[model samples]
Target chain A: MNPTACILVIGNEILSGRTQDVNVQYIARRLTELGITLAEVRVIPDQRAVIVGTVCDVRARFDHIFTTGGIGPTHDDITAPCIAEAFGVPWSVHPDSFRLLEAHFPPGEFNAARQRMATLPEGATPIANPVSVAPGFSIGNVHVMAGVPRIMQAMFEELAPTLRHGTPVTSRSWYALGLYEGALAEGLADIQDRHPSVDIGSYPFRRPDGRRGVALVSKGLDAAAVCHAADRVRELIERLGFTPAEGEPP
Target chain B: MNPTACILVIGNEILSGRTQDVNVQYIARRLTELGITLAEVRVIPDQRAVIVGTVCDVRARFDHIFTTGGIGPTHDDITAPCIAEAFGVPWSVHPDSFRLLEAHFPPGEFNAARQRMATLPEGATPIANPVSVAPGFSIGNVHVMAGVPRIMQAMFEELAPTLRHGTPVTSRSWYALGLYEGALAEGLADIQDRHPSVDIGSYPFRRPDGRRGVALVSKGLDAAAVCHAADRVRELIERLGFTPAEGEPP
Candidate 1:
């Protein structure tokens, strides 16, 4: 089984509809590339009780938990401390994080607001941020990252190399032009029944010329099975009197 | 308090990074515009136990619960029945929804897959979909919609007119060029302390000209307070020896 992971996006801005969350999609894509099955994603506001409750819930359920948002210098940035409270751990200024903050700010110039970034849960390992100096931290199985897309991307790149590996995931896709889903239903079902392990999905897309088509995607661990399923879907599309585009070989 | 809402996005494709979830952001933005607070969002897999558990948990906690994904013709689309089971109601093909589906498919052509879209909890109100005839159903406070962005957006549009409204939210933003967050920390804190209701957020933007600045956003129900807070922010920016650009007046 691929290691299951859950993402908790913490911020009032996201919930308030002020900020569109790009972190969830980015993290989800990265986790898939790492062959980790991202099972769930939660976006909670900056309320302490709710954050604590959600963190506890997800931690117990998933093999790994990743949290984004609320790690900045702002007053609403309370994810680090809230998570610590949830895990029943003492939160203080991690030395490495403090050093990174100290280096970013001039000597004796670091105020309470800027110094807030360094305060993480005790025993948490800092995830390096190349774009901005303020580091993300990892405690137990939970990895905390920044909400900013660029910074989050950098932290993930730095963090990915050190995480445990899982089974490789492969996918194949076949597209047919201007065909209704009902026309291809029986054949698609037949292909799916034959390949239980591979996940087959039909994505209806409106082309540039406003023609509709279903892009059938087959994904699983077994590369051969995935390809075979895709081929079957293509044959079905052709039988339905639609021109199936030659997609990447499964 | 405003009528607060939360979206629970369920799918393995989203968590696995194979598919990007565009629904939450759309729902969040729409909710905000409608004067409803989008308090939280969660994306779980298509598993019955997890979906039921999450739906039960969130429904009790939020004013309105909106769920997207797993409401399609496919077997993985299990949201409706699972949610019905969670609510302890018998799942059945709602007559109104079935009528709409029948209109789209015509007589004798409705298969099991197409019929799946009509299944809802007993005594559910159908939310109309203008884009596609397969209407989404709402039971109690939970509104179940499709996973596809276009379909979700259309369903939300149909449902929006009936929802309770609150105080309209308004915002003002001011940008300070070439000023770091550390430089304006104390001033920003003082301003925030003065305006408790208004939400003050600082977003760092790296300009095309290689200049960095923070866009200070003030959001609140009270337009006057938002303007007052924004003015204070602009004055503070000037004191720090940076020109603040005049943004949209509150």
Candidate 2:
């Protein structure tokens, strides 16, 4: 069985629609490449109880739980302490993280707020941030990272090599303009039935020129099964009198 | 207290990183405009147990639950059935929806696969889809809409008027180039303490040209409190020797 993962995005900004989250997609793609099945993604507020409750819930369910945001030096930056509380561990300054953050900042500038970033749950190891000095941390199965895309990407890159791997999920797709989902659903279902190992999904799209189409995607850990399903999807498109393009609809 | 909402996104395409979701943000912004608090957003796969379980879990917690995707005419379009199961209601074809969809499709073109789109839970009301003829539905407090942005937008517009509203959440923000969060976190916390009603968030950004900055945002249902907190944020930026610019960083 593949290792499963969940991204718990902790932020009021995302929930408020003030920030369009690009973090989940980036991490999802990376987890797919790493062969980890990203089972779920949750965007939640920075409220401490919610953070603590969700972290505890998801950590027990998934092999890896990655949390993003609320690790900064501000009043709402409550992820670290909340996480510590979740694990029933003491939240305090990690001597190494404190030293690193202190050295990174200039003289007399490392205030209490900045020092908050250096605190982590007892026994949690820091996930290095290549972009910024203050680090993210990992305790048990939960890996906490920054919300900013660049910083999160950097932290994930530093942390990826340590995760358990599975067979990377791969996909094959065929799309055609002028092909509607209603026209193709029966054939697609038949194809799906034949390829039980492959997951078949039909996505409908409308191009910029107002043309509608459907993209039939076949995905699985088995490359051959995925390809065979795609071939069947392509055949279905052609049999329905439409030319199949081997990608997402334009 | 404001009514709370949760958006449940159901699709394997999103988890597979094949699709970037714009539905949540659109719904979130609309809900915020309608004065509903969007407390959470969950993206889960197109699996029956997970869907039914999550739907039941969230529906009990929030005043409203908006679900996107898996309402199309394909094998994977199991959201209707799952939702029916979630509510412990009978999953069957609604006569009105059935006739509407049957008329929309050409004769004999409306196969079993297409007929699935017309099916709904026993007590559900269809939400009209202006972009496409097939309708989305609402049962209890859960509003199910299409995953496609255009169709989802249309469905939400139709459903919004019926939802209970509160004082619309509003925000005020001031950003300054070269202002670091570390330098401003202390005063921002002070401002946040003074305005207990407002939510103060400090977000750091790096311009493409490598200049770092911070945007201090004050959000609340109380317009005056939000603005007052933002004014303090602006003053803090000035006190730190950076000119504060209103709104998000360019």
Candidate 3:
């Protein structure tokens, strides 16, 4: 069975387009490399009710849950407490995180805004932030990280070595220039039927010279199956009277 | 009242991390510029059930709903029918869209795969696609468009004229180098309190020379108020013994 995960991106800045969410793609790519199936991703504003409802709903459905953004010191940053409420846990200043914050900004400098970063859910394990002192936390199966791409990436890299991984899927692709998708439909369907475990996708690409081509990609847990399916795709393209070009992996 | 909008990003490739979602940011930025508050963004796999559920939910919650991706001819592309099902509309070949598709891919070549591009929900009006012949459609307040950045931008440019826009919000950002967020805490709080209607945000940037700076951004519907607040930010930065840079409009 595939180990599935869901990501909840919490921030009003993201929804307002003030900030482009870079963490989702970073996390998704990392999860895919680890063989974890990222099933869904939801971006909700910093509103408490929405965040709480989405966290509860997604946590119930997916095997693992990851949330990015809203764990900062600002008033609009409400993800940590809301997520704690969703899990019915008490929220407090985590000792370890507080120590880390203290190390960065000593006593007099540690005001309300800086202190806010230390607050976390009860019984949560701190996810180390190599880039910044603001630590992320994990409660139950939910991993809450920072919104900033650099910080989120650092936290994920620190967390990755400990998580469970499934069999990594491999993919191969071939390109057919100036060939219509309709012309290869029947043969493509036949190849798909032959390889049940393999997933074949046809991506239409427009060349620099204005020629259209279909890049057929085959993906499967078994590398041999992926290779075999890709070979069938190449054969299908040739049968349709088009010479297949060696495709680059995307 | 704030005009609200929600974005539904539909694709299996996004969930699988094969594609990073860029359309959400494009839609969000454009909507925000029109003074439409983007309340939510949902990224779901190209599954009928999930798409329908999300579309129905978002449509109920927001003033306008915008969807991207999964309108292509591939088997995994399922956004149109799922949206139709959500609104209880019958799927049919739109005459105008059919003509457009036919014009792009002449007579005999207009096979099943190409034909799928013309399908739309009943009573839907076609949203012109400047980049591609396969046009997106709109039903009531929901605008459906392509996922490709260039295509999505083109579709939005076509649709923008028809959209009802609110008072556009203006923003200005003031920068201060080598100053920590902790140093500006008291002054930032004072500015925030003084301008409740305007949103003040502090974005920390690590310079190429390894210096840390905070870019304070002030936003509001009133341009004069935004400028006034930005001036206050510059004053605060100067008062703190830092060389304040002129606020750039954002």
Candidate 4:
């Protein structure tokens, strides 16, 4: 099994439905490519206690914990200090981070609030931010990054390669028309029982042109087992009077 | 204070990043409109123990818990049974649900797997599904629905009217250009302290045409206080030497 990971999104905007979260998909795909199992993702509020508590809980359970949002200079951006509290470490300004911001900003532009961005938890490594001068920090297993998609992406690219990884998971999808999940469930269960390692998923989708179907997918670390299960799934679909299509549904 | 909610998305496709979750956005928007505070959302895998444990935890924490996915007829669709286990109730096939499925499907097509859709926890109420015959069930505070966007939307619309709601939250957003969050953080924090009841959020956005800016938002149950805070935010942005624009940044 690959080293597991989790994501904690600290944004009240997302919870209030004022903003649609795009970071989860981006991080989820990147982690999948790196052969890390994204065990969970929690979209939480901007409160300090909640951030500290959730970070502490998830940091203990997963190998790597990625957090996005609430790293800005505003009063609402409390993720950094909360994370520091979570780790029970002394929080202070990092020299490198301070220098980077000092070089980026004009004279008098680096105010007290802006300087707060340079403050990091003790013994933390700064994640390079190409989009903006303010850098995110990595403390222990938790990687704290910006909420903005571009900055978060840049920080992730800089930090992802250094982390340990395991076997990459491979998946195969087979779409079936005029076949419902109920009709195929029994055969799918049998295949699952026979090959307990691979994970099988059935998702129903309706196309815009009045077509509807279910897409059956088999995924696992072992390519051979995944393929075998997919083949059996396709065969089962055909036996149930529906042709198994090669690509995805809708 | 408003009645709170939490969403539990149970699926492997979401965890694998193979599927981008749309249900969260839909539910979040609906909850926001209804004055229900959607406090948290957790996307978890389909494993029975994880599902049951998460469901149990969230159900106790929030006034209402909405779960999506893993209610299909396939082997991986274990949400209904796991929910039953979470509530410590006996799981059994509901008479009304079986009849609904029996009528929807042709005589021989209504197999055991299809019958699995009819099974619900004891004393659970069936949430009517207009898109599909397979109904999602409501047990105590937890409402379990299908993962597919269309079905989930329909189910939510049907069940939303029955839920208890608080005052609808009002928010105001003021956009500003040329001024970064660092320059505005101090004044914003002061504004936050003055309007202690309101939630202020600062989100930076880059426009498609190469312009960049931050949008400061103030939200609260009291519309007058929310407006007062927004006015202060607008003044704060202007005093920081940036022209405050109305609405969100483009």
lDDT of each: 0.82, 0.91, 0.82, 0.91
Q: DockQ (Cα-based) per candidate?
A: 0.54, 0.79, 0.53, 0.78
Tell me the docking grade of candidate 1: medium
DockQ-derived CAPRI band for the predicted complex in model 3: medium
- Segments of candidate 1 deviating more than 4 angstroms: A106-109, A246-250, B106-109, B207-210, B222-224, B246-250
User: lDDT tens digits, residues B2-118, model 2?
Assistant: 999999999998887888889888888888888999999999999999999999999999999999999988988999999999999998998988998898888899898889988
The top-ranked prediction according to TM-score is: 2
Q: What TM-score does prediction 2 earn?
A: 0.97
**For model 4 chain A, the run of ten residues with the poorest summed lDDT:** A176-185
Fraction of native contacts (fnat) of each candidate: 0.50, 0.71, 0.54, 0.79
lDDT per residue as tens, model 1, B87-200: 999989888788778878867778777887788888889888888787787888999998878889999998999888887778788887778776777788899999999988
User: What overall lDDT, based on C-alpha atoms, would model 4 receive against the true structure?
Assistant: 0.91
- TM-score: which is higher, 2 or 3? 2
lDDT of 2 by residue, A1-250 (tens): 8999999999888888888898888999998898999999999998988998999899999999999999999888999999999999999999999999999999999999999999999999999987888999999999999999999999999999999999998888899998888888888888889999999999988888888888888889999999888888888899999999987776
- Model 3 chain A is weakest, by summed lDDT over 10 consecutive residues, at A241-250
Most accurate candidate by DockQ:
2
For model 3, name the residue pairs that clash.
none
**Residue pairs whose backbone atoms clash in candidate 2:** none
Predicted structure 4, TM vs. truth: 0.97
Q: List TM-scores for all candidates, in order.
A: 0.92, 0.97, 0.91, 0.97
